[model samples]
Target chain A: MKRRQFIRTAGATVAGIAAAPYILPSGSLFAATGNRRVGHVVFCMFAGGVRNIETVHMNDGNLLPNLITGAGGISPDILGGMTALPAAAAQSLQTFGTVFKEFRYAQGPTGHFNGHTTAITGQYTQVDLNLRERPEKPTVFELYRKHNNPATSALNAWWVSNGLGPYPSLNYSNYPGYGIGFGANMIAANSLVNADAYSVIGNTKNFTDPQLAKAAALRDFLDQQFKTLTPDSARLNTASDETRLKLFINSLYTKAFSGQFNDPLQTGPGVMNGDLYNIAFAEEVITEFKPELLVVNLQGVDVCHSNFTEYCDNIRKSDYAVRHLWDKIQATPGMANDTVLIVAPEHGRNYDPNTLIDSYGRRAFDHTGDASSREIFCLIAGPSSVVKQNQLISTNMGESIDIVPTIAWLLGFDSAIPSGLLPGSPLTAAFN
Target chain B: MYIHKLNIVIITLVIILGMLVSACKKKETTYYYEVPDAAVTGSSVIKPNQKSTLEYVSILYADLMGQSIPQPELTRMVTAYEAFGDDRIIEDLIIRNLLNRQDADIPTTPEMRANPTQFVDAMYQRFLVRKPNDYERMYWVQQIQQDTSLHPDILYYAVLTSAEYRHY
Candidate 1:
């Protein structure tokens, strides 16, 4: 009669039913190989901090004038200067109107490292030292990799960025040797390193007759090498290391086939619009793998620290990248039916006029002060008509702890996994 | 015995079905306040008790500028009062002046250094507009001299709450 007893009995029944293959068609077997009950998620983490007044709650037109109809003190020329983009790019911004309607601001500890960790883990801790020394917590990526069906060749989750310090220290993530520095290096490496013959076979999608033969041959060679090179004494270590290596190799081929493997050429200099790169990369991955879940943290907005003049401009660019990702997913096959995109900032900037001036005369206010500085937007968009359109969720009472459990709920995971680390409730307004 | 076994199996199945149904049903107990549309509406009404202390000081400077008070008289009054009260009021005015200027540098001339009465009078004219009640003015003057450890924020809040600061 109790909930646990009920779940155990139901789970046993479902397990018995699921073990039988006679109930499924031959084509359904392929669906079973991939995650049949899985839901795909593309998360856009607006790294660094975005001012709440400027992006989400900009009722006044001081920061972004274009967002307002009749402005107050801001000049028209300055507003136009901030948004001088092509018409097609400008139109893409509207797809996010529904997303912005469901926006919820997240609050947490104010530093860059702490904010980033909280954004992924949905747990707040004062991690002042290096991120590697921080306590372990399960990220959304870790959860998916642990529970999702593993017959697929590619990685179930990836952490890619142009330059965002170190990846969150979660045990289950597949860190694809890509950082801000490595992103540039990878781009350059692509141009210099010739494609290997083995890589060429992996890049093609000709899975019929001859290609099938080639796949079998490659699998056989690897199996024989795996046997001779790795003894049974070190099987566990060798297997894990080999699995990681295969994942890396498969990711490279996935990139090559998608045509994004060629080093992304920087147009001028500096950090080459990481927001734009993340958008392009997510699009390529969705098209190739149609992954059950993906997380991409865009870092160009943090360039505000370098020069305040670029802050608004970077925000607009990041907004456009998010819109583009959503639009592509809506158009992609199979994904159009059941994918959801959640976009949010890791933290926010201080609005106090005192600390607004930096060494370069740039506005660098305190981000750890009152509630305003801690406010940053969270947006969710999906095919499921769950949330009411154009609805706003007040985040004053919410904390950074709600995100992971909310994500798990949306993915239909059993809530029995007590999210003790996250003490807040899910944003039920986001669901039907 | 056979009938008992059947009853147990049926009970287990019923319980399992109940769990699935309950779990699938959305949680209805959570409550959220729908964000009001009026929060984002634009208006031009001047809010009461919202002018910061720094803004009040700027009003004082504007009044002095309007009346063409000599720099020496203004500096003397401000400096003499600076020693009697919290230093942040005088400090805030100096900082505001530097920020508003194109060169972004504070004035350091002797004429600007020795004027306090003229500075106070000018600020009273600009910020108070009409005039402060005799009792209110006396209270402020007495408090400034007596309260040497007041924080800038508290001073600003006090100024904002004043009737003269509210109307102007």
Candidate 2:
């Protein structure tokens, strides 16, 4: 080969080798060691906040009448999935998971953005309620992906947020050390379902000659415009990683459009529930990609800010989605055997009811001012061997930030590095 | 058998050449961030002409569709691009949806089929906000002419989904 050609080929080969690890599947990239007990971890952020009264510790049928008694109870799992302290007479304590009913947002700003970020990053940031900025610290996804060194092509981590607002930046952190590239594959579930994005993006087979020409002509036009800007300015992935991710997403979108994977909201009363759609899609992702870590953000229950009846209804739906989502995950072929699921609301609701009432004349509860917002709970469940089912760890006294370290401990990724001055530690007491 | 022999020869050659290249460059690194240095503090690297995210999204939307993208959809588009690493797929879907709208007055099938070059030219004007150069016009016209299966819709989709349409 000519000298110039040889240099070019060698450089390309080196770049390929460097990028190869990130462009491969996680299974082929990292061997499961004895220390790695958890094969997969799913973190479900029951966002928009939930109150302790409505969850974990509902007083008979007083707080949420519908969940406990009204019209023969909407969700059996809501009652079935928790252990009431002292065992309430009307409610049973039998559950499929361990619930930390005494948990609180002991640290961090007490709201959706801060709580969720703290839950994922194991650190607190003073970032305002504005959703403009990503987390300052590395998230559990970035930590797992970076520490484990999964191939970029492997769908190692995903964040399926139910809404688009204040959530656009949470898929990854903006930390200088761990930013853009290492972030999770985020899907704004609401955008996907509500916009019927699947129908438009997934219908690739119908690309007629005319359509291709339009696309090409647009490309040609755009190319000239791009010339005025500085070249190579965009933060682009390695060509291989880009190609693989695009193809994988394209195939998944196709499968979604084909109705191969059933969306719960696609039919019946579930269609009215956005949280259910998010859960169904989360389940689809878990089954399809089998990501090492998956974060599901469901915020429909936040309707309590205005409409109490809708809020209660949404909580019931969210509860059902949670139970159904877990069932689906456990039933999925690869995920069934070994997956750790953590479900927790970002924070809780207000102590006092607001004056404004919904169409049902039921009073609403806001979460911003009251200390009740700090009151939240977490449920951790996985294989019987890993965690004792139906166990309650109320005495552990954990914060939302502890979730990241706990996940790290479970997956045997990186522990909370105290030397680095990170805020939270693993919920080691939750483990057997 | 001959192809296999050629592959083996190429592999060996690549390995030798790669080793030579690596020795010359002691460290190969890709930095995701630029750390500030106190030691070399004076003038800052500035590119004032760089396009803001809003400018990039708005200009493209207005130029292509002759109307502002609804604020909500625009916000979602920006979010999709910023949160997710690549927004090419989202852009394509958005453009298709926008053009397919009833009021978009986008070319009908017959209009696109009758004057293929004219369609391409209009696409350039709408999407790029400039007329297509002779070379671009000729190249696409020739491709469409040569391949009867090549449709005008494909050109529309192409221009709508191009990197230029996405970025400023």
Please give, for residues A255-338, the per-residue lDDT of candidate 2 as tens digits. 656764464533343244677777877876776678888999888878788876667666666665666666678788778858
The estimated TM-scores of all candidates read 0.49, 0.67
Tens digit of lDDT per residue, candidate 1, span B104-123? Answer: 22223232224423333443
Off by over 4 Å in 1: A1-38, A59-77, A80-83, A88-108, A131-135, A148-154, A168-272, A353-362, A394-397, A414-421, B1-168
> Model 2: runs farther than 4 Å from truth?
A1-34, A61-96, A152-154, A195-205, A208-272, A306-313, A352-364, A369-371, A415-421, B1-86, B96-160
Question: DockQ of every model listed?
Answer: 0.00, 0.14
Q: Weakest 10 consecutive residues, lDDT, candidate 1 chain B?
A: B80-89
lDDT of 2 by residue, B70-160 (tens): 7875766665554343454455455565555555546765776688788878877776556666656777777667666655456666665
Write the residue-wise lDDT of candidate 1 on A119-220 in tens digits.
Answer: 666676565647434334555554443333332222435444434224423212223321111110011112111243222112322123443343334334
Complex DockQ, candidate 1 = 0.00
Please give, for every candidate in the order listed, the TM-score of chain B alone compared with the true chain B: 0.27, 0.54
The local distance difference test score of each candidate is 0.47, 0.65
